[model samples]
Every structure is written in C-alpha cells, then in structure tokens.
Target: MTIRDFESHAPIVDEETFALITELEVRKAVRLQYFVSLLGIEADVEDGQDESEASRTRERLASAIREEIRSCDTIGLVTTEPKLYILLVNANLGNVPLIIERIAQLVSRHRRPGDGLGELTLSMGAACFPSSARDRSDLFAQVGSLITEARRDNAERHRYRLPPAES
Candidate 1:
C-alpha cells in the first residue's frame, strides 16, 4: 500500500515543496505523515492602536517569532489584513501544543515594557499537514478554521477580540 495519506486543514498555506519522507513509528513504519502549521497572529495583546502602529507591532512580533522558531521549522509570513505568520513543523504532531505554547511565550517575552498596556497577545491557529489535509489548499482552509476558533477562544480567554484574521 502507498504510504502517502495527507489529511486536510486550514487557514491557508503555500506548501509548495513536495516530498516523500519515510515515517517511522514506535515499532513500525507508518503510512501517514503530518506537518503542523501555526496560523494567524496572537490578538490578545497589542502595543499599537492605529493601523501603522499595529503594522509595526505585528512586524516586530513576526520577526521575533522567526527568531524563536527552530531552524528546521518552515516559517512564512502571510500578507493578510492583520498580518499572519506560518510555522510548518514536519517532525510530527505530538509536539504541536508545546510549539504553540513556546510561540505564545516568545511573543510575551518580546513585548516592550508596557508602553501603557502590559503584555502583548496574539491570536493563533494550528493545523497538521498531511494529516489534517492532503493538498495545500485544504491545509490552508483548516488553518483558517483554527484561526476562527482561536479568535473566539482568545476573545473569551483574554477579554478582547484578538486582532482580526490576517490575509
């Protein structure tokens, strides 16, 4: 049987490179592989209130996120409304939650000494490539779904609407 089952997910991804990397499980070879991706910007915290200011804040946060992510992670900056960053993890899905927490913390650490507001918060969604989706488009959509879920979740968890979904 062919070991090329890729699932579908969202918000949107440019998974251009195609590969057939072998996947090994605890005691046997697996027929499925997964790539995890983080979608959207954390919206809970912010330093800028206006468009230009918000853009700059987002740029800084995106840059910071890039530095925090590992070298192997595929990081892509999405040019959407709120400005989103994407992290593609190829190792496995088991580490996804940890990765997300690390990202959240990284953003927190980079936040400037309360220019008035305290910590910086962002909204994010994550999806597993080849597991949540088989094609790039589907993966993007799933990530987007997560982003929607995240916005609502963040709104409730943080108290404010996280930045609007990025382009």
Candidate 2:
C-alpha cells in the first residue's frame, strides 16, 4: 500500500490512523487553545447502479472534497461504505458550514453529463472541538448523530419529491 504524508491532498487513511490523528489533534487543541472540526460525509448513490459506476461517483466526490479542503485538513475512510471523515484543523463551528457549502458546490460542478449515473447526494455532519464536544469521542458521536439527521432529512425531501435543502 502507498503511504501518503499528512499534507497530501485528502489522503485516505484507515480508521485506526484516523482516530489516532484525531486524538492527537484534540490534545493539541487543549494545549494550543485552537479549534478542530470533524466532518462526517456520506455519499448516496442511486440504487440499481453497477458497482463500477458507484465507485467512479465516489472517486469524483472525493476528488471534489480534496480540492475544496485546505492543506491542513485530513480525510479518512472508516469502512467500505461511502462514508468519509474530514479533520479540519483550526476550523471553528462558524466555519464548518461554509466549508460544507463549498464542498457541495465543487461536487456539483464535477458532475458530468451522460455518466450513466443519477444525482449523487452528500450528507454531512460537523462537530468542533472546544465548542461542540469535550473530546474526540464526543466529537465523533456528535458528528455521527448529525450525519444521521442529515440523511433522514434528505430522504424526507426525496420522499416528498421536494427540492434539495439549502446550504
């Protein structure tokens, strides 16, 4: 397996490594009095699509996210599912929404015509250290809850054939 440095653009790390880095960041935040934000992003691909198409959509989404994030941020994959984690160093609660909006716009721009794919929806949840949570575990829990809520909201909009939610 290839190893990517921390500064690499959206380098995909495993769960253990991701957790370790997040814990370290939490510690640093305690000492430095800086904020750290964690975002849980999940991509929803259309059903009945082939595995290859879904994989390509995921790759494109990841690329778009990588392009929007800063060099200090980190991305990680915790499972085979389309869920991803982004560690935003020095980002505060006020900034997470802006970052998420930017990512959504970038992903929308990256979509191509005739890709044999339906709309790729992204559900994101964010928690900031020192503001939203006491530590890494709490941060993770909050992010998870937020992601779930976002997904539910998205599904509700789709069920009613309503327009997408505003950023």
Candidate 3:
C-alpha cells in the first residue's frame, strides 16, 4: 500500500490503495503460503491541555513507529485519529513481541523531552492472516478489536496508581 495523503504529520493510505491491498490479501489467502501479520497501534497523549504540543508529539511518535518497520512492511494511518496499522509481510506470530518491543524502544529513544506529557504509551495488537483470520475483513475486525482491548487494558492498568508517598 502506498501512502498518498497526509493526515497532520502521519502518512495515510488512500481508500483505493487500502482496498487494493485488502484484495491482494484475500487473493494471497488462497495459497496460504505466506504469513502476514496485521499489527494495530494506538497512541495518545495523556496530557491534552496543549493541543498543538500534543499534535507534534503524536507526529513524532508516529514517525518513530514508521522508522521501526521493515522495508517489506507497509505502515499506514487507517484513521485520522491516533491509530496506525502495519501490514507485516512474512511475519510470524511468535516474533510479534520482539517487533513491538523494538517499536517501543524506537519510540522512546526518539521522543523529545516531555513529549506526550512525559508518557507516550503505546497499545499494540496483532493478528495473522490464515491463522488469526481467514480473510481481509475478518483480519481487520479482529485486529481492531484487539487493539481496542489492549488500549482499555493499558488504561485500566495506569488509571489509578499513586506513587509511594515520600518513603
């Protein structure tokens, strides 16, 4: 998929290219010879008081994510909102954690001081074709749901944890 448009600082695939890639995935499903994993990433700024700063941080974070993806992998902003999806060709489910860790490391390593309110957390979810899903639409739906769940989990985990009081 080619990103022909820009949403803020993020590269986004046009609807036509997105559909074409979906069709290609469907066709590839017939052989079941290739392994493709769809990784969904959601990033948001914790402190949204400064809209401009938040936008810049999100852009930097997205750029970092794009840098981490392989040449064979296709990254695109599926929505104008804070979300990205990577179509990793020949990717294995077993190695997903490593990939995500790499992404997180890159994001953190490249982040400017105090970007995203000092905590630019990433929520990741992945689904493999012919394994987690049998078709393009199913793959999209499953990964979408997975990312949403992951985001919810992250939020809950960080929602109400007070630091130690001057121990």
- The candidate that wins on lDDT is 2
Q: Residues 46-162, candidate 3, lDDT per residue (tens digit)?
A: 664476666555555656666566655666654443256777777757667788878777865666774435666776777777666777877777776676666666544212111
Q: Where in model 2 is the C-alpha error above 4 Å?
A: 1-8, 50-56, 80-82, 155-167
RMSD of 3: 8.5
How many angstroms is residue 103 displaced in model 1 relative to the true structure, after the best TM-score fit? 1.3
Superposed on all Cα atoms, the candidates' RMSDs to the truth, in angstroms, are 10.4, 5.2, 8.5
Worst 10 residues of 3 by lDDT: 158-167
lDDT of 1: 0.47
Residue-by-residue lDDT tens digits, candidate 2, 1-167 = 33344455766666778889899999999999999988887777788778777766665666567767876777876664326888999988778777877877776576688765586777777888888788999988888777677777754321111112336
**Two-way lDDT contest, 2 vs 3, winner:** 2
The sequence of per-residue lDDT tens digits that candidate 1 reaches over residues 1-167 is: 23122223212222232112111111121233345443445454444476666655665655566656665444443445235545555543455656667766775566567554345555566554555554545555666666666676544432212222335
Q: Which has the higher lDDT value, candidate number 1 or candidate number 3? A: 3
lDDT value, residue 110 of candidate 1: 63
Superposed Cα deviation of residue 90, candidate 2 (Å):
0.4
